[model samples]
Target: MKCNKFLKGISLSVVWITLSICSVSANENAAEVWRFGLEEIEGSVQDIYAQAFKRKIEDKSQGEIVVEIYSYGMLGESEDLTNLTANGTLQLTHASVGILGAQIPEAQVFTIPYLFSNNDDHNQAVLANNPAIYEILGNALIDQDLRLMTLYLEGDMVWSTNKLIRKPSDFAQFKMRVMNSSLVIKTFELLGATAIPMPYSQVYGSLQAHIVNGQTNPIFSIEEMKFYEVTEYLIWAGQQKFTTSVLANQAWYLALPAPHKLILNETIEELTPYIFEQQIALNNTQLAAIKKSKPSMALIRLTKKEQALFKTISTPIRQQFIQNSGQPGQRLLEALDKALATEK
Candidate 1:
């Protein structure tokens, strides 16, 4: 009889332990889940960052907050995702700062040609050392129902084309695909190229069909889009560098539990430096890989004189951005100038 009683006791203990584990899992399931939308394909830098963000946030929060990333237009295109994120319909998104200008015009400053001397200046201004620039930019977005997180370093924008483009005059009459930003369109127009505004999804097809003669994108994106498959040249004019950002729905972000908010802010702080460094390294790797794989794709490094000609032609467009960005823009520009000067 005592043996049977001992067996029953063991079974009861097992049931209690199983119930306790179930209860803990149920509590974890109850934690809030935020959906992060990204347009980059799997293995791209943007997608890599999204995965890192999700991992760090969930790990730090101990599952009290969950981040689920939907990539490769799984959510929508960049413009659509930005709008959804702005209205709280979507929780988060990653995009170039220029794309947010429609919601906050001051963001256009980042898209201006030759904005940063190189990646290090851009990194300091956006992430490491410049609080003045961040404050001005963050203030501009606070009222727009979006929150600016940090400026991500991608790479300098390079022009890829089928024709050799070593000088400013060579750009004349070339049809180039540009983003929806007016500043980008004007930049290409100033170069004497016809700027065709097209969604990123269509870039490959457009290039294949020769719908546009070429497009401008980061060297990484040029590889991601496989533009070299159809095109034969890469122009290193150093005219513009791309700066992406992490933008959240202000309403959703502000209402997050204080602890959860702290986790996210902390995650950004930890990840920014790593991302800045990784992107610079990745740009070099991807550029080399593309060139080795596709020997037909040639590179044109513009002479200082060639870059000078571009700067001279694009001066009016840059001035217009400053004049039109308002006082906030002026302040941000001055702050960026200070940052760049100090870094140099």
Candidate 2:
């Protein structure tokens, strides 16, 4: 019975039960076991990516590599999971950018509102495998003993509040829930709101109890977590999205054989497009589900002029991100600008 928690989505084949077994290899090299942790539950984009990677690596290595997945709370929360991975207890984890930003401030560069464009392909190239992102930010993370892999673009962050948030002024009366990041706190403050920093797991209950008047998350997350049930309006701010990261333990990654590393990198390359497609589909489906379930909940898609109002105020947040990120932040910012510009 306890094993059910450990193997909730071993293959994610069965609805409630999973039956997966790595084959007994006849290869000379012993099989390597990797523990991968996710920030979302099974069937979410992160889990879908992890499962795909697991299947690919096991097949590519001829069973030389076996990836074991721990869905969300199965192991622990973001901070605990990331700590375990860094300490070599786990090989990999999908961590929230806000949590990662606390230790490696350069990561906070992503907290800057309206950093990425509306173009999906443009965002994907810069985020998924761009040297500008991984090479610049990745090099910095190595000093902290963690290897930055790739960024997962879940969807545009939409706000769920009992009232409409049509402009920055609307935020003044709301206590906005944000991740535990200084940049995020300041971002909300600059937008004229009282930011309540908390863990992701607490958002739903906080909204239900009126502890937090509003929260921002991708539509899929809001619908999946049932945040819509307690909130009255879904406002698409289009300022920031859920851009989490995949990371590996530096020591563990560096110690891996060249062949093993090759497999890991190649698998991630293939997982990128696949996961991106999944995120888009999942968000679209979930948004419809939320609308169907909460017929009275108003959906506010901010006009271009309205979005520009918030985007303009977000400029100071970028400067603050650079200050928080230090020297690398400048280079990282420049690199991102260059990448995005070139994409245009």
Candidate 3:
């Protein structure tokens, strides 16, 4: 009887151990299948970033974490993705600063027209020795249950129009499609154009129908969306240097193991320069392609004086934004200004 009792106890112990092991395996498996989504896949940016992110996650997790990417609005629109991420329904998203700014008004500072004159100027302002600006922006996002993982790429924005935008006066009677941002709407209005806020997906159609005469976008988008086919002129306003952020749901990110998180952060840092290089190359190539394919399309270069005139007209809009965003926006603008000055 003593022997039988001892044997029963040992069997029970073995069963408990098996169950615990299975439970752990299940939990780890659950964490491994990560879902990453992007709004569009029109360029190699999305592809390269996704690949790099997945590789890092997998490597860091020792093959325990696998990331699946959905692109081209496969999951939903940018706003929908933002909401889902905030609620922890989605794992990750890559969105332009415009969409991010709409959600977190402080991000709008990046969208301020002519915020950075050129890529080097913008990189110097945001990239090197700039902890405060990124911290403020990332913290603001974290407050809303999101993590700003990385600033993925910078693309130069220019105005595409059917008419020549030779000077600020040329914009007097123009109507352009602007994103749903008060700053953007006001900027165009201040620049002497009628600003029509619309979804990006609709901009192409609007331009096709002649409902709006012009819009601004990066060269990659102009080539990918075939915007050059509809617009006869491309004015190099460089009005906004576009950037995107890789965001993760806070809950999901927090659930990750310490090693996994470290891996992701490190990977993002390593991949930043490569992504930036590709973006610059693609933008240049697309511009050349547009010029070659559409020989009639004119690329307008604005003089320094003209750019200054445009900025002067748009100053009031910036003031209003500062007033509306209150201290946070004001602080962000101040930080950006300081960074820009330090760069020079």
Pairs with steric clashes in candidate 2:
none
Model 2 agreement with the true structure over 35-137: per-residue lDDT tens digits: 7988888888788889999999999999888898988777656676776666565789998788788777888887788888778778887788677678778
Report the candidate with higher lDDT, 1 versus 2: 2
Q: Pull out the clashing pairs in model 1.
A: none
How does model 2 score by TM-score? 0.89
Candidates' C-alpha lDDT = 0.77, 0.81, 0.73
Q: What stretches of model 3 exceed 4 Å from their correct place?
A: 1-31, 117-129
Reference-based TM-score of each model: 0.88, 0.89, 0.86
Candidate 1 is scored at a TM of: 0.88
Clashes of 2: 0
Total clashing pairs in model 1: 0
lDDT of 1 by residue, 4-111 (tens): 211222234434533553465456557777778786888777887888898998888887777767776665467666755665545888867767675567888888
Query: What is candidate 3's lDDT per residue for 126-164, written digit by digit as tens?
Result: 753367666778788887888887775457778899998
